[model samples]
Target: MMRLSRKAWNNVVIISMLLMIFFFNGLHKKLNTQPVEEGVQALLPEQSFILAMAFPELKIERIGTSWRSQSQQETTWQGNEQQLEQLVELWQHQKLTIANLPVSKISQTSADYVASVWLAGEQLPAVYQLYNIDQQYYLLDKRLQRVFELEQADAAKLFPLYPF
Candidate 1:
């Protein structure tokens, strides 16, 4: 067996510890923001803007907190990550990037906004709901009449889900 001096042993131990910490930190950091559970791209502009309305700062700040709060609130009413993932997919497909959507106006102290956006070359109406603390946006499926609740839409059937 090879023997090492005390100084060399200490140096090796310190280097190994430092390397371990760096490797673990990088690995965990990426996992923390894992791409919205697959099949969901980045938020589009109009949708991002609309979503931003749910946050008091308009998605400019505290976005993570807002998202978490929104998830909790919706989940309390039977919403789940599946629905949120589907919604995110739809938003990505809609070609709505955050940069293209801007808050037209904030109506009073409420989180909703009057925003101008172009869809198929026409202006549209978009509404955003803020979490209780004005942190995150609660994305509702208006067609289903559910606010913040997530449910898979039926293709061949017509049924509406409502949020309480």
Candidate 2:
């Protein structure tokens, strides 16, 4: 029978302990880590949103599950409840990705429209600008360079025509 030397035995024990530690650490991280969803971190209240547009300088607010808009003519327009909810949901779940270009590189001078969203009881709104680059629609944050790509149809929903 052959026996390992004391030094060899100690080395073996140490290496085994290290392997166990690494294995358990990886398992712990895998089990504890949660998947993050891509979207705005802000928690939107139920059936509430305030949408403000730049081109037309229009402001719309959700009042008691219904949407009301103030047009350029200084008239109030009532919005469809279901349509409003759908629009709000689209914005709420819209997944955002990091923009390849920085804010300085992107030119906002040719931007056709800008929109901002504010939740109920919130003083500040999340601002976004809509731009068409090479016929592709891009939605970008005013303060941040993060951008979201969407089809033209989806982008059009952000600027719904109000019934006055």
Candidate 3:
């Protein structure tokens, strides 16, 4: 059997111990690093809304429109019954089935005319709502998925379907 001398063995043991010490020291330095707040500040932001509004370049797609009652005492945005029926019929002709048609569901403050109908081949069906309190028409933005209160002035500019 080939044997290592005592001095050679000692040298080998010393080299292994030094390597072990070096690895442990490196591990200790990593564990003892200062608090992570410095590294994290760049990742997390302090403000979100200001960032959205200030950067007008960031396009915000309209999700829907809100209608307000012409008169404060009116309580609801009233539309001609016949006109509403025709609107529904027009949508039906386009192959969209509306649920809860011609029904008024009253809320605490206002009444909502809601129709669940699908648009084209989209999996998420769009909601058609006529709010009685505001007595106006709103188009829910399918992309943003939120209803916007429609302004009579901005109505024409927002949706081409109904020009006011």
Give me the candidate number with maximum TM-score.
Answer: 2
TM-score of each: 0.27, 0.55, 0.22
Who is ahead in TM-score, 1 or 3? 1
lDDT tens digits by residue: candidate 2, 18-120 = 9999999999999997554455333233455455323255665666656665655553433565766676677665554444555665564566677778755
Residue 84 error, candidate 1, Å: 26
Give one digit per residue, the lDDT tens place, for model 1 in 1-164. Answer: 76999999999999999999999999999888644322322333333333321222112112442332242132223324454344434543442112111233222245332211223332453433322223333333222222342122321011112222
Pairs of colliding residues, candidate 2: none
For every candidate in turn, the CA RMSD to the true structure comes to: 16.3, 9.4, 20.5
Judged by lDDT against the true structure, how good is candidate 2? 0.62
The local distance difference test score of each candidate is: 0.35, 0.62, 0.37
Displacement of the residue 106 alpha carbon in candidate 3, Å: 14
Give the runs in model 1 whose Cα sits over 4 Å from its true position: 36-164
Q: What TM-score should be assigned to candidate 1?
A: 0.27
For residues 1-164, could you state the per-residue lDDT of candidate 3 as single tens digits? 75999999999999999999999999999998745332112111122111100011111111233211122232232334454344333433322112222232222333233344434345654444434334554433233333444445433332223324
Model 2 is weakest, by summed lDDT over 10 consecutive residues, at 37-46
